[model samples]
Target: MTKPLIIGVSGASGLIYAVHALKYLLAADYTIELVASRATYMVWQAEENIRMPAEPDQQELFWRDKAGVKTSGILNCHRWGDAGDNIASGSFRTLGMVIIPCSMSTVGKIAAGLSSDLLERAADVQIKEGKPLVVVPRETPFSLIHLRNLTTLAEAGVKIVPAIPAWYHHPKTIEDLVDFVVARALDTLDIDCIPLERWKSS
Candidate 1:
């Protein structure tokens, strides 16, 4: 049986990162377990001016259309408030978890073990289970508080994958930049969904 990987989308600004992540993962035929916070919906509206479907099942279709995926990747969308979901438990047996465009609030909550919702709870499960937890934080101009919270997670074996794109790759298009960061995030989990090339200095 192919183990699914958990993908958490918080209320972060860079929703595109999460979208690109889904595109890559789905194209690679990897099963995904996705949970997006209610804040994610709000952010999607404010950022993209499009209202994401509130229903989990509807959201699954929304993502599929966005990815334009022809591959057979399975996606299981969970409600943001569903704490009883199996992904919230360690026994659920996932490959690990990745929170793309991770919000500072989610980072702090997970760092303090204060899970108010499904996204946070699933992240907590990864920590307790000793499974890989990768967070691609998108906020900039980090204050001390944000740094401290991120540092706390890093100390606890979480991979703090930044959303910064590499210029060495000489990216010319916006998709190039997005894919570069997505590549970094999945690589942290050993997924290699994007599989960007390694840098070679001249």
Candidate 2:
């Protein structure tokens, strides 16, 4: 049973991507170790008019155990500093790790090998374990500093995917754009999904 870790950061914009990805992964029957940053919860409240899981005990928001059946078991949210957690080690096999809407600060920290929190730590573990690590950064008007940080991680084999949705998809709604990027990230992780169409030189 292959699983993936989905980390949501407060970097800015696009919580929908995390939600959609989590939904799809669960629907696909993959277990997920989840992490949501403090700022991410705040952003969810301000922008999306939603609340973050209050504590690790709020696992019901993600985990669903109905009539002793594990339906919708994709996400298992834990405290960011829980280094003693199961997903903290490479021995716990997983398909990959993704940081959706990854913040520049977090990106720099991970690039520089600083794992101060569980999300960063899990990402570091993924890299060290030689597993796929995809970072979804939603910043625009890129600075040299951002590019350098992205490049640094890229050189180390991390997939630094900027959350720039393709216009070629003819998106009808914001959700369409979000799904397009998430689908691309899943593709990088080699997860089979139905997403956007590729640009062709016609």
lDDT of 2 at 201: 81
Reference-based TM-score, model 2: 0.87
With candidate 2 superimposed using the best TM-score fit, by how many Å does residue 84's alpha carbon deviate from the native? Answer: 2.5
Which regions of candidate 2 deviate over 4 angstroms?
A: 6-10, 59-70, 195-202
Best by lDDT: 1
Q: What digit string (tens of lDDT, one per residue) describes model 2 on residues 1-202?
A: 5655555454467777777777677777777777766677677778868676758767545333211224655567878777667777889788888898888888888899997777888888888889899999988888999899999999989997788888886899987888888898888988865456767887
Number of clashes found in candidate 2: 0
Clashes of 1: 0
* Candidate 2 clashing pairs, residues 3+ apart or interchain: none
TM-score of each prediction: 0.97, 0.87
